[model samples]
Each structure stands twice: as structure tokens, then as C-alpha cells.
Target: MRIAVLMTNTDESDFSNSWPKDGEKFPAMMRRVRPEWEYVVYSVKDGVFPEVLTGIEGVLITGSPHSVNSGDAWVERLFGLIREIYAAGIPMFGACFGHQAIAKALGGDVAANPKGWVFGLVEKRFADGRSLPLYASHSEQVTKMPKGAEVIASGPDCDVAGFVMGRGVMTTQYHPEMEPAFIAALVEHLADELPSDVTERARASLVKEADMQAMAERIALFIEGQSA
Candidate 1:
């Protein structure tokens, strides 16, 4: 499959080579999921070419520092593009900001959580255990489920963790692409902002350490199951 990974942030200072640290971490995860597939990385922060998506088999929209609800023209444009992609019935998987974008595009709401942030690997109870092994570290969660979206997974903080609309459009609020070591790096970076309790909770959820191969296998199964 020709999969395009979209990078939405323009913060050059965020990490080395102008890519988010998690973006760099995900390819290793992808290799284990579909070794034969070609995965290309694109920066919407640079600009998006709608033509690049024509023959693509799948699109995985990565998390961003920016919110989908931001009053940016580019955000609106990307949402429009995603709407087109979704309409074409191409498989799309969105994480974090990508999930928020999916929510916004589908006539849902995105706002700061009144409960504030939920940072760590939260114990999410799925309606069915189809969405196990979720890894997330974010403050805002989707409170209201979008129209025609399935609430596959949920937790105390967010009622919407996983959602599938139509045939192949799917999203997860969790970061299956992020592992413990990666989250450790993020934790260190956000030390001041992250509470001690949150960090401890994340560490408790660590299994298999930072084995990208295993995480990739789990993610691959999840994606393939979506196709089935």
C-alpha cells in the first residue's frame, strides 16, 4: 500500500530535522506493520498537494502540536482534503490531532476539556476489547461522539477514543505509534507541565519496554482488522 504520513506542525524548533519526535518514532512502528508497503512522509506545514493523495492506498494523519479547532486556514483546508479522502473510501487512520480533525470535519465539536488535561497511558474500556494497547498522552479528549461515528473505545476522561465512519475511515485518540521510551522523552520535555501522578501512571502501563517490533505488530493487526 502507498501510505502517506502527514506532518501538520510548522515548529522547526520542536525536534531535529523539523519533524515531530513522535513522527520519527512511528516509521519504525510502520516497518513492522507492513514491510512491503511504501510509506512517504509529507509536511502539511510546508504545504499539501491534493494530487499526492490520488492513488494512495491509505493515509495516516499524525498528531500535531496544533489543534484542529485553531482558526488557521491551513487547518480548514486539510479538513476539507480529509473529507474528500474519506468520501473516496480510502482507508484513513488519524491519531490525536488527526482524530480531532476527523471529529471537526464530521460536524463534531472540539474544545478545551473542562476537566483540563489527561496525560498518561489511560486505562480505556472499549465496548469490545478491539482497541486494546492504546498509548496516549494528551490533555484534551473528545467528549461528544460525532454523528454516524462508532464509539469503539472510551475511558473516564473521554467518551470517544476510537471511532469508525463508513467503510474505511477510522481514528483513535490514543497514540499507538508512541511507546514508553518515546513517551519518556516527551515526559522529560514537558516535565514542568506534567504532574508526578501522570508520569507514574504512564510508567505503570509500560509492557515490552520500547520494542517497536511488537508495537508495530499490534498496530498492524488493528489496521488490518479495520480493513476486514
Candidate 2:
């Protein structure tokens, strides 16, 4: 499958240099399940996007530090592209900021989390009663579901941890592409920015393994138009 990745991360901190680029994280994780797939990345944060959508089987939007409500020109353009993709019946998946963007673009709402920042690993209970642990690092969330969207997962801290719109679009408020080591490093790197208690608890939660492989497989299946 040929997937177009819209990378929106704009972090240039020293910490980012120690890890793989944001554009590479999703492909690295998805490759475990789809090694034969091809991925092309566009730095949407810098106003870059695919010139043509022909032959693109799927589009994956990566997490970003920027908020969807930032009102930047590129952000608005990305939203327009999202609408175009949806209208064309192309499969799309989003994570974190990408999740919020999808919701807002589809007539939903997003706002700051009333319960405060949800960092580290969180156990999400799905509508089908399946529970899975996933890494989270966000202060904002989707406050309203768009028309025709179904809430797939929810947690105590986040009402809409995951959602799906029809068979073409899926989103997660948490980061399944993030590994334990990467999240651990991120927690420490942003220790000064976040509350000390949050960092401490995030560190403690790392002891339990996240269901990354399972989530990765599910994403691959969804992108392939199979039962996920």
C-alpha cells in the first residue's frame, strides 16, 4: 500500500535530535506489520503537502506540537485537504494533534482538557469493552464528536480517546507510535515544562508495557480496509 504521511511536528529542541524524526516514527512502527508498504511524508507544518492524491491508498497524519486552533495558514490549508480526502473516500488516520484537526475539520469541537494534562500511559476502555494501554502526551482533546463519528475508546481523563468516522477515517488522542523509551525520554525532557507530579507518575507508569504491537496491527488492518 502507498500511504501519504502528513507530518505536522515542529519541535526543534535539542531533545528531538536524539531520536528519529517525527516523520519517521509512524512508518517505523507500521512497518512491523506492513513492511511491504510505501510511505511518503509531507512536512505540513512547513506548508508542504502532496501535489497529487492519485494512487495514494491511505493518508496518515502525525502528532504535532501545534494546536489546531492556532489559526495558521498552513493549518487551515491542511484542514481543507482533509475535507478533500474525505470527499474522495480515501482512508485517513490521525494521532494527537492530528486527531483534534480531524474532529474540528469535520464540524466537531476541541478545547483544553478540563481535567488538565494527561501524560504517560493511560488505560483506554473501548465501546466493545476491550481495554488497552497507550501513551498520551497532550493538554487538549476533542470535546465534541463530529456527525457520523463513533467513539471507539474513552478513559477517565479523556472522554474521546479514540473515534472512527465511517470506514474511511480513524483517530486516536494518544500516541501509539511512541515507544516506551521515547516516552520516557520525552517525560524527562519536558520535566521542567510539565508539573513535577505528572512527570513522576508518568515515569512510574512506564513499568507496565503498552499494547503497541496490537495497536499497530489494528492500524494496519484499518488502513488495508480489513476488520480492525
Number of the top-ranking candidate, with TM-score as the measure: 2
Candidate 2 lDDT (Cα, 0 to 1): 0.91
Clashes of 1: 0
Clashing pairs in 2: none
Candidate 1 segments exceeding 4 Å error: 14-23, 195-228
What's each prediction's TM-score? 0.83, 0.98
- Candidate 1 weakest lDDT stretch, 10 residues: 14-23
Best by lDDT: 2
Q: What TM-score, to 2 decimals, does candidate 2 have?
A: 0.98
Candidate 1, RMSD to the unseen true structure: 3.0
Please provide, for model 2 over 1-228, each residue's C-alpha lDDT reduced to its tens digit, 9 standing for 90 to 100: 999999999887788877898789999988988999999999999989998889999999999888999999999999999999998989999999999999999989999998788999999788899998999999999998999999999986899999998888999998998988899989998999988898998889899878888888888999888888
Positional deviation of residue 72's Cα in model 2 after best superposition, in angstroms: 0.6
Give per-residue lDDT, candidate 2, residue 84.
90
**Root-mean-square deviation of every model:** 3.0, 0.9
